[model samples]
Target: MNEPFAGAAEKPIPEIWYGIPHGYVQVDLDPPVEQIEELVQQVLALPDGLRAQAEPVVQFYAGFVTALNKQNARACLLGMHLDEYDEPATSVITFSTVPAHGTSAKAIIAGTAADTVDGSAHPLELPAGLAYFSEEERRTPAPGRPAEGSDGPLMGDIWQGTVAVTGSGGSEIVVIQLVTSAVEMAEDFRNILLGVAHTLSFSDPSLSGDEAGTGAREPEPDSVVAAVRSVFG
Candidate 1:
């Protein structure tokens, strides 16, 4: 199958600089407003106990939406865009809540971009996995080969990095896999991804508190296979 993103490739290493593969998950508040409002009204009309569980959900949703909007704008400024294949720009603010329950909700966004000697590539592969990671993990680095262009250790394989967020009522994560014709460029990409995560944490208010420290755990290989089957079945 094609890689999660469209422009991914496994080309040979470059002579100039290496590319960095980085990913992260960020936690931001997202709630289905209309649905929550409607639910709130219904709960208020009901007995007190029924409304209690629903109240946290409403609060969580409100916080989520506020965070999502702010983060979306921030991503755009950082050269990231919402995954149009899955969600429209307008609908980004709508109430398409997932079928799960809790005082929390989530919104995932991710993509890959390349920086060449010439120009940068568009972001790709904003998968649900990346989204979930943004909410849970802080910064998780997996073992992978280094890219080409390095003068010391690690000279011809890709390096992977990830960051995530969780807590309150929701979570978000982003992962990046950096590789390039030039090992230098790859290393640069890794640093850039790290900087981006830090910047996101600083700018986005919802990523505050213990939630921002949450790290995403990798799913088991078997579970991954099952998920893929469910999606493509």
Candidate 2:
């Protein structure tokens, strides 16, 4: 038996992708699977009329997984779509795992419409839960404010950043801290940071230039850093 089994074990799947560690969470949306299941169950429980209306919405959510797989194997998201009118539409959100290397995980979000009316394509808003940091947290630490020593501010621990991009337009905000200890935390942070960066680069009105093409502006690094720190503080 030992002879028969020797050197015959199945090789473990290597967790490497695009040169990044294979163990990190890699998706646009990172909602708890249980929460998603619960939401599905609730939708299933609705009456036919409600279910009929909700079917397309649910399909859109499910399609996110497919979209991620199709666009970026390592990207994913927790997103939803609402029909402002009774027309069919499809939206795509892209997530990219970032920070290049060293297990400091992150990702970004960008949205595009397959077919729709004007203004249909826009970056989706970050959910409240993800934006845990208050505006106060984003404020620069005052001269006398308690400095983060070895053990940083309690709020800083849950920091996150966000960038929403819609058809070359969007906004970004940073969350200071969130209390998640999974190995994937870094990846999550990266996603939010990239999302914010992409949105700012593509959308912020300050960066827009007139037909003369003379007034292109760049986002302030301090603002970007503050946004990231606010969430990860």
Number of the top-ranking candidate, with TM-score as the measure:
2
Residue 222 alpha-carbon offset, candidate 1, angstroms: 26
Quote model 1's TM-score: 0.24
Residue ranges of candidate 1 with Cα displaced over 4 Å: 1-36, 73-231
lDDT by residue (tens digit), candidate 2, 55-132: 778777667666654533333322222234633222122333223233211123321222323643334343211221
Clashes of each: 61, 33
lDDT of 1 at 13: 14
TM-score of each: 0.24, 0.28
Q: Lowest-lDDT window of 10 residues in candidate 1?
A: 12-21
Per-residue lDDT for 152-213 in model 1, tens only?
44423333334332211343222232222222233444444433332221112222244446
Flag regions of model 2 displaced more than 4 Å.
1-28, 73-93, 97-223, 226-233
